[model samples]
Target: MNFDDLRTGSAVHQFPGVLLGHNVRIFHPHLVNLYGCAIGDDSRIGTFVEVQKGAVIGARCKVSSHSFICEGVHIDDEVFIGHGVMFTNDARPRATNDDGSPQSEADWKVELTRVKRRASIGSNATVVCGVTIGEGALVGAGAVVTRDVPDFSIVAGVPARVIGDTRQPVSKAELTA
Candidate 1:
């Protein structure tokens, strides 16, 4: 669908400031909240997804439904973000400051999170801020990532630990005879 067609009623909100590259498909556009973000060409954003301001999604990425891509999050090309994935941009989050005042943008710094090229984050994963999920890494389902995942590694569980490596070639001996 054309980007102009996305400009519909109040139910769907795709701000004019959002920079969408060629052939970017937002499935169920009326169910998504995207603003001030840059989605590269051939990317598909699923329903119930909210891509916040300053978030950059690279080419050929698939962001599944019920996912939240907060500010300062950069998803590289060919990344697959599974359903119900949550990305945090703050190492410490508080609604109010010590002075008993409501916290504003200036109150805290946004920590950047990067999901490198070809990384696949599984469903219900919680990716903490200031972590770089290295290239071709596989984050297992329900993992809570708190640190940098090495390249071509597979991580699972809370505070995600490296369980395997993706670059390892499958041996015939390990398979059925």
Candidate 2:
């Protein structure tokens, strides 16, 4: 049976020759086409997700539905990207340059956004360009992240602010004390 024959609720739009690793699961294969992107092993991509050219998603990541992973985005291993998440790569966004002409590839620069290992981005979060989300950080839902987030920090709200820190793993002796 073909992909169209599968009786799923939605269809995935996977572009030909997407570099998907072993054991990857794409629910709506017809709704996403990751031609130039590279998804690592054991990753799961939900419906309506679009991973643009040159984007790299590391191993064991979960990218939820309606998320847009644009070019210049690099997500490390074990990351959790929630639903409706948006990643931007252009800081100075404009239709035209100083010459008043339409912008071309050479006229703009693509800033890199890096999500470090084990970070969790909540639903509807908008991550701006040129920011580093540190390892194990938790970004709360609906947060607009505009700066670097420290490791194990929890951030929320517009232009996201650090609200708390993630609990570090404690040994049995420390827990008893």
Candidate 3:
């Protein structure tokens, strides 16, 4: 392998002490800024993934390409964030304030969004602020999550209504298999 011929992107650390756990891989790191974020062990962040300030990603999580994880977002262990998934911190986003000035951080509240352990958010899903995606819940592709999802449930559509329950009664053989 020729060193000069190899193509690689830089991982720009804007903030000091950004804790990255063991065996973590960030691809095309130069395309985004990872500031004040903590990524856990065995995690993989794909190209164009922007993990903003104060965002916490747990162990063994996979955040795909072009995903925006803003502040006040907490993703638990084993979570899957698909490509193009966007998370909003402000419920009501405004460009300017009442006095015709640009809205700063103090102008609005930053709502918290939590994705519980083992939850999977599909591609192009938009997660609104102040919502908790329950454990093992699956948000379908292009779904807009607006509220708290129940545990082990499958949610889809514009408002992300519960489509089905993942917890089904199973036999001993099924569990063993």
Q: Which should have the higher lDDT, number 1 or number 3?
A: 1
Ranking by lDDT: 1, 2, 3
What lDDT, from 0 to 1, does candidate 2 have? 0.84
RMSD (Å) of each candidate, 1 decimal? 5.2, 7.7, 8.3
* Tens digits of per-residue lDDT for model 1, 91-111: 989999999999999988899
How many residue pairs clash in all the candidates, one count each?
Answer: 0, 10, 0
Residue-level lDDT tens digits of model 3 in 1-177: 112322222232443546677677887666756877788877899988888888988888999999999999999999999999999999889999989999988997899999999999999999999999999998989999999998998888898887776676434443222
Candidate 3: segments with Cα more than 4 A from true spot: 1-15, 168-177
Cα lDDT for residue 113, candidate 1: 98
For candidate 2, the 10 contiguous residues with the lowest summed lDDT are 1-10
Model 3 clash pairs? none
| lDDT of every predicted structure (CA atoms) | 0.87, 0.84, 0.84
- Of the candidates shown, which would achieve the greatest TM-score relative to the real structure? 1
